[model samples]
Target: MANVYDAEKKVTVNVLNKEFDLGLMIDSYGNTGFRLNNGVFVMGPMAIFSKSVLCWNVRTVIDITPESLSAFYLLEPKLDILVIGVGNRGDKLSPQTVEYLRSKKLGFEILPSSQACSTFNFLNSEQRYVAAAIIPPTNVALNLDEEFDAGYRRQRNLRLYEE
Candidate 1:
């Protein structure tokens, strides 16, 4: 497993497709959990996520749920895959967790950051299962058009991390 570099300018992270912002992703195989930016973020159902979104109407965001993560893992088209995003914590993914994943017969790759996210995608695009780690929904983000593979949409578009 190669290490994901924190300094790289552009790297792709995925929830469904390639992403330029690392904050919007998490290491999820249906229901996997992760630590991002000092706090923990987990997903549930669209209804619940939607409620959170409605409750926080002051900001722009998306509702992602634990059910979403679990559905991703349990989806019929699932690929036997696993991704570990390592950043906030240096501890090893516990043996219990690894054992549970093994029980599910998942193939695995652990990554340090976005580089690993890209490598996993490039290697497994034909299949479906993929995951990543990230902070939470951010007000600041990279627009899809800017990094969608045709080419960069904006060259010097500097955006701040959302509050």
Candidate 2:
């Protein structure tokens, strides 16, 4: 596997022989946090936007508030959607926070960290005006290969135990 922390880490997508920089693309993630396409490995939770990445103070879904998300509200050009990654499992935000976003006319999607990462990457690739507030999962596979192998092992173990 390539060193995720290497300063040379970059993944580009080609479109008609022209490569575009996916600066906000999440290259990898683990308990510590995420490795971005720009080769910056951010620790702890983070708020990712198209132009910048900020370290978030939130540790759990319960820590999420409109106050915690003040940065998103201040973004220029506005955001089409905000993706909230609620750690290892899917969780709901506080009613107050939900109401706050709605009142601001901000659309959002709450999902597990894993799914949120993928969704954010996809939207970013499409050049959509999107942002993400992510809480790193305490236990997670660092890459797709690891995730697939882990799932396959789990299924095999389950069959063996059942038989």
Report lDDT (Cα) of residue 110, candidate 2.
Answer: 85
Per-prediction TM-score to the true structure, in the order listed? 0.35, 0.72
At residue 82, candidate 2 shows an lDDT of 97
What global local distance difference test value does model 1 have?
Answer: 0.34
Against the true structure, candidate 2 has what lDDT? 0.76
Candidate 1 Cα misplacement greater than 4 A, ranges:
1-72, 124-129, 133-163
Model 1 Cα shift for residue 107 (angstroms): 1.2
**Each prediction's Cα RMSD?**
13.5, 9.0
After superposing candidate 2 on the true structure, give the runs of residues whose Cα lies further than 4 Å from its correct spot: 1-20, 141-163
**Least well predicted 10-residue stretch by lDDT in candidate 1:** 50-59
**Residue pairs clashing, model 1:** 26-132, 27-132, 30-69, 30-70, 30-73, 43-65, 43-66, 44-65, 44-66
lDDT of 2 by residue, 3-118 (tens): 22322332211111112386567876666788787767899899998768999998888999989988888877889999999887747788998889888888888888878888
Model 2: lowest-lDDT 10 consecutive positions: 10-19
